[model samples]
Target: MNNSVFRRLLLPGVIVLAGCSGSTDPETAHLFDNVKNLNNGEYDRQIASKDAEAAAIVRQNNAASARISTLRNQSASNSAEIKALTSQISSLRAQTSSLRGKFSNQPDKLAQLNQLDGQLVQIRADVGAGTSPSVARAELNRVSAAIRALSR
Candidate 1:
C-alpha cells in the first residue's frame, strides 16, 4: 500500500517538472518571432524596389512620348513648306515656257533668248537647292520683264 501511494505521488511530480522545463535559451525561445520579422522586412524591401522601378519606367515613357510629339510637329511644318515651294516652282516653269515659245521663231532675238535660257537654268538650280520661294519669284519676274523688253 505504501509503495503504491509513493508511485502515484512521484508520477504527478515528474509530469509537473516536465511541463515546467520549456526552452530556456533566448535564441531558441524567440526563433519564430525573429523569423517572422525578417520575412516582413524582406517583403517591404522588395515592394519598395518594385515601386522605384515602376516610377523610372513611367519617366522614360513620358520622355519618349515628348520626343515623338516634337518630331511630328516638325514633320508637319516641313510638309507645308514643301507644298508652297512646289506651287511656286510650277508657276515659274509655266512663265519660262511661255517666254521661250515667244522667241523661238525670231532669228534676231536668238542671242537674247540664249541669255535668258542660261538665266532660267541657274534659277532652276537655285530652286532645286532650297532657295526661298519669295527670292525665286522675284528672279522669275525679272526674267519675264527682260523677255518682254526683247520682244518689243
Candidate 2:
C-alpha cells in the first residue's frame, strides 16, 4: 500500500513538470508569430522580384519581336524596289539603244547617247548592289534628261 501511494504521487508530479516544461508562454507565441510574419514578408519580396524579372523578360521579347517584324517589312519593301528598279533600268537600256541607231549620223548626239548609255549601266549596277531607291531614281532622272537632249 505504501509503494502504490508513492508511485501515484511521483507519477503525477513528473507529468505536471513535463507538461510545464513543454508549455509555451504568451511571449513565445508572439515571437513565433513575428517570425512567421517576417518569413511571409521575405517570401512576398522574393515573389515580387521574380515577377518583375519575368515582366522585364517579356518586355524585351516583345521589343525583339517588333524589331524583327520591322526588319521583315523593310526587306520586303527593298525587294520590291529592287524589282522595279531592275525593270526601269532594262527599259532605259532599250530606249538608249534605239536612240543610238537614230543619232548615229550626228557625232555630238551619238556622244551624248554613249554617255547616257554609260550612266544607265552604272545606275543598273548601283541598283543591283542594293542602292537606295531615292539615289537610284535620281541617277535615272539625270540619264533620262540626257537622253531627251539627244532625242532632239
Candidate 3:
C-alpha cells in the first residue's frame, strides 16, 4: 500500500513539473511577435526616408547642372556680341582719325576732334577689359553721336 501511494504522488508531481517547463504562454508569444513587427516597420520607414532624401539630392544636382549650362551659353553669346562691338568701335575710331586729319587746320574743330578721340579710346579700353555689354553699347552710342556732330 505505501509503494502504491509513493507511485501515485511521484506521477502527479512529474506531470505538474512538466506543465511548468520553459514553454512560452500564448500571450507572451504574441507580445514577442508584435515587438518584432514594430522593429521591422521602423527599419522599413528608415529605408524609405533615406531613399526619398537621395532622390531629392539627385534632383537638386540636376537643376544645378542645368543652371550652369544656361549660364555658360549666355556667357558665350555675350562674348560674341562683345567681339562684334569691338570691331565696330575700331571702324569708328578709323573714321574719326580720318575726320581729324581733314580738320587739322581749324584749331577749334581739332580740339573737338581730340576730345572725341580721347573718349573713344577710353571706351575701347573699357570694352576690351570686359565691361558689361550694356555699358559698352551705351559708350559706343555716345561716340557715334559725337562723330555725327563732328561731320555736321
Best by TM-score: 2
**lDDT of the candidates, in the order given:** 0.69, 0.80, 0.80
**Where is model 2 more than 4 Å wrong at Cα?**
1-38
* Order of models, best TM-score first: 2, 3, 1
Off by over 4 Å in 1: 1-40, 105-152
For model 1, state the Cα shift of residue 117 in Å: 7.7
**Cα RMSD to the true fold for all candidates:** 12.2, 9.5, 10.4
Clashing pairs in 1: none
- Full candidate order by lDDT, most accurate first: 2, 3, 1
Assess every candidate by TM-score: 0.48, 0.72, 0.69
lDDT of 3 at 57: 100
Cα lDDT tens digits, model 2, 70-138, are: 999999999998888888888988998988789778998888788888888998888888888999998
lDDT of 1 by residue, 1-152 (tens): 99999999999986675555343333543444444445557546756788999999999999999999999998797667657655654665565466677767776686676777678677767777877757866886787687667757
**Model 3 lDDT, residue 68, Cα:** 100
Model 3 lDDT at residue 46: 55
Candidate 3 regions off by >4 Å? Answer: 1-39
